[model samples]
Target: MSATDLTSAAEGHGTGSSVGTTDLIDVEATDFMPDDSVAGAAADLPAADVAVRAQQLTKRYGNLLAVNQLDLVVPRGSVFGLIGPNGAGKSTTFAMMASLLRPTSGRIIVMGADPSKKPRTVRRRMGYMPDNLGVYDNLRVDEYIEFFAASYGIHRSEWTALVDGLLELVDLSVKRSAMVNSLSRGMKQRLSLARALVHDPELLILDEPASGLDPRARVELRELLKTLNGMGKTIVISSHILAELEEMCTDIAIMEAGKLLAAGPPREILERLGGARTVKVRFATGISETFTVADDAEQAALLRRLLVDEGRDVVEFVEHSGGLEQLFMTITEGVVQ
Candidate 1:
């Protein structure tokens, strides 16, 4: 039940196999034809400025409105993180952008193509790694990567080198011959990432990628993602790990109850949302004071008044900006839908 099964079935590589509901929910199936109308409209956008744009996107499951009029834009070549609590519809939003699910209302443009109308075009340019690894059973690590490579229509001769490069990229070259089921959770997560990159996509959509990794594995994943972003790939990631996201993401969107609470560069959002910066000052006279400022200008004015105007013997001055965890706690009311 690997993600390759969904790719193979969707891309016409499999015969008439049936995919389970759980598999369908977690994996991306991309084999639909393109629509010229949607393609032409998407082409009107400035491709360099945006990678993914959603205009009032909505999704409903019968009586449940999973995603509600969520509007978002991910700039190209940026690491965008989606933050939300459980039942926040982040996964639903990702599924729509990946072309695995159609929106109940509104429009979504991914890589300048409408995923609902031009799924093939969108899917070919994007790679998706879900939270669950699915079932790998007896497949070897190399075999698993090769399976996805073939599913993406890569030549059989090129698979050896491709698999080698991907395994090395995920630091799993030594486990190339080991059974996928025998690997630990972290190793399987890395393997799944390799599977997603088999086609060398321009965009990567990762959901809870660091869900079960150890601290070392999480650090490795963060560095690897930064490397990929440096290589000009736009990454959209969703995680409850706010600290990691704060360190790695260039832009972030916070969602709650299927609604966007904030979206932009972290600093800009912090400034706009009235996030305060704490300044600590120590004097040579064994006296210390702490002040909270709203922005850099205020922080600078305070420093100037103390050192120049007051003529005080300031020994140390340090400023601390609020972190993403604080922002999340401040903005979200713990509401789950």
Candidate 2:
């Protein structure tokens, strides 16, 4: 089908970090964000143009296997999401991918290079922000960004324009003179992001980058991510916040017991959850068990139209496409050792 005729698809991104109004992608695009539909898949990403590739990537710490033979791909320029329950090897896998932790076996190739063997080379082209990624307590926002810039050996003449430009992009320009330790947790998160963009690396691996942000802060961070995505930056964000992830990612990998339980577009995964689509039919009273609709398209459409056309006392009507949160709860619930 043609791109426009389809339900959802990637719109071309703009120059600044945020995507324009046309590209508010939804769906299971990734763990952190889902597109409106499966193929609303970003057109900018090259097919199989993997920025991060791990196969049978296992990490065994003594007798404990943190990551068990996991395999996945993040297409170049795609904002991918990596999700799992708490302690589901999400951080461990991120460590392995970022070359922060050594693996017991298996292979990992990121951006055409083996990070384990050529870490410095790989790191030059990649940025990493761990769940607790830290900032310099003594440095001001500008100085913090400038420090990473200098570390990258950015040109002296260019660093000023570049650092200031990025700080503004992340909305931290006002805080440029503020000491790192003085900023709130959310502000520090933004600073961490600014540091990651210092070199304009080809790939970004952010672990729960929005973890503790307040609602407004989280929304701003989400918008910033969309902007970077529009600029063709490749991203792999790991999070357990399925609702937030639902807003931004294009492709997703759900992990349990150190293995990928499901890997596909978000919408498809929900469809695979089986049974009558969980439709929440709101009325004056809670939906009674006695109230049931037949499992047929006509019945489904009628229910939908009734809600849409009449705007009845229907408080909500989310057809239970078992969402990512539900899926995560299913796979990881009580599964952690």
Top candidate (TM-score)? 1
**Prediction 2 global C-alpha lDDT:** 0.69
Cα lDDT for residue 274, candidate 1: 40
TM-score of model number 1: 0.85
Per-residue accuracy of model 1 over 190-256 as CA lDDT, tens digit each: 8888888888777899999999789998998887787666656789999889989988998888898
**For model 1, where is the 10-residue window of minimal lDDT?**
18-27
How do all models score by TM-score? Answer: 0.85, 0.77
**C-alpha RMSD of each candidate structure in angstroms:** 9.8, 8.8
User: Number of clashing residue pairs in every model?
Assistant: 0, 24
7-59, model 2: which lDDT tens digit per residue? 12123225423222122121212222222232233323432355766667799
- Deviating ranges (above 4 Å) for candidate 2: 1-48, 280-318
Highest lDDT: give the candidate number.
1
